[model samples]
Target chain A: MSCIIERLAIVGVGLIGGSFARALRQAGAVRHVVGIGRSRANLEHALSQGIVDEISFNATEGVAGAQLVFISIPVCSISAMVGAIAPSLAPGCIVTDGGSVKAEIVRECEKLIPEGCHFVGGHPIAGTENSGASASFATLYQGKRCILTPTERTDREAYETVARLWRVAGANVCSMDPERHDRILAEISHLPHAVAYALVHAVGTADAEGENVLSYSAGGFRDFTRIASSDPVMWRDIALMNRRALLASIDGFSASLAELRRRIDSGDSPGLAEFFTIAKQFRDGIL
Target chain B: MSCIIERLAIVGVGLIGGSFARALRQAGAVRHVVGIGRSRANLEHALSQGIVDEISFNATEGVAGAQLVFISIPVCSISAMVGAIAPSLAPGCIVTDGGSVKAEIVRECEKLIPEGCHFVGGHPIAGTENSGASASFATLYQGKRCILTPTERTDREAYETVARLWRVAGANVCSMDPERHDRILAEISHLPHAVAYALVHAVGTADAEGENVLSYSAGGFRDFTRIASSDPVMWRDIALMNRRALLASIDGFSASLAELRRRIDSGDSPGLAEFFTIAKQFRDGIL
Candidate 1:
């Protein structure tokens, strides 16, 4: 397990970035780590926890002499962060991201990086409701999917270098177009998040026969709405960044729900049974 | 833990009924158990497993010498089963049910029971995806809630007797009016089932950018839709029996989803954050 990377810069060393740093370090993949963030307290906390060897408030200063830069910031802020650090990065440096939405962020970042330096869009689709460097662990990315979205401009060597690092950290890396990644993720991830939030809101506000039904809910209701406990700011940003796909998904979901409502409303026994059976079969297939 | 009942009749020796027989026997509270069901093979399985002391195909014949009769059948079938067994039950027989919807079943069963006998509506709010007597367990109701719906006409001693049986099964027993039980369950249980089925249907049928996005889903989506794998016939019966309350809950859920859709469609960052924030807060409060 010799060192695969000489020096790495981790921008916004929160949960995702911090976990990346720790996982890479445990695998002996990276030699040096520089953590960057807006929160001085969080950066210092990361430094104290040995998650980062060094801490920097300035993006340009932190990325200096780094062979690879990994940005794990908010989706809306990624391109700007890349632009700020692009001038300081050495020639032939590879820059990758861990944003959930890829197409928009990838397009914005590809143009921001200077010539001779490479930008590869990536999404390590693993997370929890908890945030900050304190919540990170060395095995958070283990056995998870880390999708690399490589465009026409992406450097083959740089892409392999990024994928290799994720693989060493116990992630299954696969490559796809950034546009395809966003579309698929909308249905599987973002849309479920929106539906979970809406369900929680509905149950929280309504009372059945003057009883607060939400409070009396047991394992099934609780398990179904578990994703509603996710971080609000992160989810809000995701909903907006993946707006078109998410909105389309919402509409699609509404139509499906309406179909179910029709069956129940008309008391269509055969129709209802068929609907549930189809759903169960599909779910069982995936499982 | 001495024998609390000399003989017990279990009509429909399926998951609920079979589990009740197993749990009571393990607690040493019932000396004789007679399992009655349409599926002779399943009753034989229950008998072979030592879950029941005897097996009978006819409900009337099964309850001949039993002092307590427990019917764990579909909601629509409970009253008819009661009517069939009422004439055979001895005097002072305490009959109860394990139907999800109580109000309708209780009313129907109460009128069918003979004067000397009593009928109580009970719902064991616990189960798994698997069905039949083979899935029976001695601790299926451990640490779970078993809600009993008792009306003014319900016999006081008979209600306590039913409560004691569930208590011995390791259930937390509570009483509520049948109407209130249906209303609360519509929000907490029935509505969630409908939503889960609709979500599964939506993902199963749609392809994102010509890709079946469902095959790529992981833990969150699977856990959220676990209830969708439930028995279709049981859910269909529940939907029809609790139509009015379930329909109202569905409307409330649609409104909640529509509000969220508006927030995302308009790109209202603060509004989206507020909605998510409220949802997270509510979910947190319950947890």
Candidate 2:
């Protein structure tokens, strides 16, 4: 395959960003790669690991002549990074992001693109609890789903280019509106994270003879709380950035939990069994 | 190792009961094993699989000359099983059960012990979603915790014999008050199951443009809902059997979730971050 892009720039060279750069380099899809991050140590590590050809501390200077600028940062910082890099982008430079939430970033960053530049919202539904440059690998996105949200004003060529980049990284790309993407993610991702955090907090705060009940937690509890061990700041930003949809999801979850609680309290054995049956069927049907 | 018991009678030859019989038989700790259950097919399967030397449909008749009677059934039926086998148990037989909840079972079953027999509540902290005689294995109790709850009236010799049986099955035996056992288990086991079920029910009921959201569920969601795929009748019986502790845990979890909701609604970024940090720390500390 021919080189898809002559120059590629990635801001926030952490797990997601470093993984993207490594995968593209291994695939020989890009000629030059530049990494930008706030931490000097992480940038140095990325350089030594051959994840990028060059490094920059400033987003504006990083994308000076790049044909693609991938803003792989926390959800909260994506908007600011886009604004910072807008003035220095080359003509027709396609800008994309790797963040969990889509609507807010797309809404806030679309108008900041330069006249000849393009912006597309992208999210790769793949990661581990570990972060930083050392934790990234080339196969991080293999067999994963990458959702791209494009508005009516989005340039079709730019959107296709971003989708191709994800495909090169071994991801299956799907397209949907920003609003719908955020709503679907809220139900599947954000709501489950919230439930896990709440569960841990509840068990931690319970008065159970000052004993550490976690030592006795079985395989099921371990599996259930695995997501609760995610990065704190990243999840906090996601919970706030998608506040409206997340709140709606929480309401729906609360209502369902209340119904289960009511059934248990009323000694309604049949109702409880039916509730569990429905949940089990849905759980078993999960792909 | 010397044989621990001359004869072992297993009531309800399903997952737990069959597993106990198989594990003991593998250890060469029992001379004869009699399996009893309502399902003729399960009993026949257990006999064919070498999980038991003989099969019977009547619990009372099965324990006639047995020196050890192991009752493995749902928590709800332990009381009646105890009453049925009390009259048939030999003078020096040791009776024990494998049930999730201890207080209720111990309370009702202790009184039914015959004049010279002993009853000890045993709970092995091991199982999978799959149940039945076919799922039984010799190593099911290896490296697992088996909690024995003994009352004041319990015979010391019988309790030690039960503990040794669990040890022979490759389990670490621990003793605690029945009430304390129920309380701790409610937090670690029952509460997590309830949360998983509620989460599944919540997402299953969401309105997402008629799309099956579970089809889009990623690895995290799959791990979170695994326990929700458990046996519905089993969980329902557990919920009703340990109602008080489960209810308290539900209330505590609601409070925690409510606090998280308030923070998200107010856009308290730092507070949300702290909540996730605490949860992550606790989750990481889990063994």
Candidate 3:
């Protein structure tokens, strides 16, 4: 598993990319790691913090001669970054990502990548409330799931390389079709963000004429607020890119919430208890 | 602060009572602490672990010489415990509680307390997911808020004694009327539990009909399930007893959720972003 990716280039030096760089270096998975992002201060910060071997403010310079390239920017800006690095990527370079949704990136890569190069859509289901390079750490991906979406035409060698890189980063990689990946994540990841954001919205603007006690919400609402505190641009892009699946999740959640309200109103105590118990057991089963 | 309560009796020696006992002892506010509960095993366990100076199986016998009695049972059974202990309470004894909702318990005390005793309603707004006496620690209430509701007829001396006890228990005590207390708590505490229970209910029940991937709910859904994992009987009683305020909170939450869905469906990106930003700022202010 040593140096699975000979020289890995991260195209965005944010939390995910910086964390990937740190993890790869700490795990000794690559000979060299280079980071590219928009800010000079962040690049300098990442370099001083040993997040990368070299810092490239330009996308093409960073991707040059790299065996594996990880596009770890906001989902909305991924297309422009891919187009910028398309001409400079090595002939057999394996390109992947750390985006929340997979389909849009996979589709964008299809039209942008050269015929000989490889493209495997990936999303490591891990992170924290904090963002940016300084917040990154080597153990960020430990024991987390990383999902890869590879088409039939995608090179098997390229997929294996991507999977192994994630493994070294302490991830368990699973392969799925792009469509299924989006749908599955819509239920598990995207929908939760949307619902959390919506709950915060409701609590904040609720009773505008009143004291608006969202300030005092400490228990569950605090957690909802923390989840909603994620990078706004990143989340907006995820919601818009995975629109269909995310909408369907909202519908599912709405139905369930409405049913719960009905049960409470009807004083169906046993039904409520059963509902809570089943959910508790389901959560207990998860890591 | 030394031995303000010379002999303190704590009924239902679970997480709350056990923590209270530990905090009182650590602060040197009670010279002797006695544990009481229906479960003999719990009483024996509490005594063995040194959580209390002594243990008593009979609720009446536990409060015999004690100056202060804390009813820490589940909300539904607090009234019955009050009735059972009224005959045995020493003259001028101060009775308070650790229930979530305060109105019903206050009403119950007014109906059942002995003529010479005083009852003040209380709620300590602090806890964790874990329960039982073993989970208790002396610092459980540090920097947390505690609400005290005293009726017009409540003895000033009794009310002050209860407030002083919570202060020694490492809580910031605030006084409020019983009805107002219920309304405020419904929004801050009870509604979050209902929403969490409902969210989990939706996801768990869906798995019965389909390939419900509650397992993959890694990010925001984790928070909902964590809160939903609270004891079912406790939450049920809170929801039933604080019905009106909880119902209002539910309605408020639904209105906000509906507005979010409408904005998303209409492609109102700006509106959605504005909602998200405002919510984020509001939450940031609170945290």
Which stretches of model 2 miss by more than 4 angstroms? A207-209, B207-209
lDDT of each: 0.90, 0.90, 0.81
DockQ-based ranking: 1, 2, 3
Q: After best superposition, candidate 2 residue B133: deviation in angstroms? A: 2.1
lDDT of 2 at B87: 83
Interface RMSD of 3: 2.0
The CAPRI classification for model 3 reads as medium
Best by lDDT: 1
How many Å off is the CA of A89 in candidate 2?
Answer: 1.1
Determine the C-alpha RMSD for candidate 2 after optimal superposition of all C-alphas.
1.6
> What are the per-model DockQ values?
0.83, 0.83, 0.55
Q: Candidate 3's error at B16, in angstroms?
A: 0.8
**Best-performing candidate as measured by DockQ:** 1
**Model 1, B14-84: lDDT tens per residue?**
88999999999999999999999987799999999999999999889989989899998878788898998
- Compared with the true structure, what per-residue lDDT tens digits does model 2 show for residues B1-287? 78988999999888888889989988899999999899889899999989999998888899999999998888888889899888888998999999999999999988888788889998999888778899888888899899999889889999999999899998999988988888888888898899899989988877445856776788889888888988898889899999998898899899999999999999999999999999998888884
lDDT of 3 by residue, A154-185 (tens): 88998888888888889888888888788878
- Candidate order, lDDT descending: 1, 2, 3
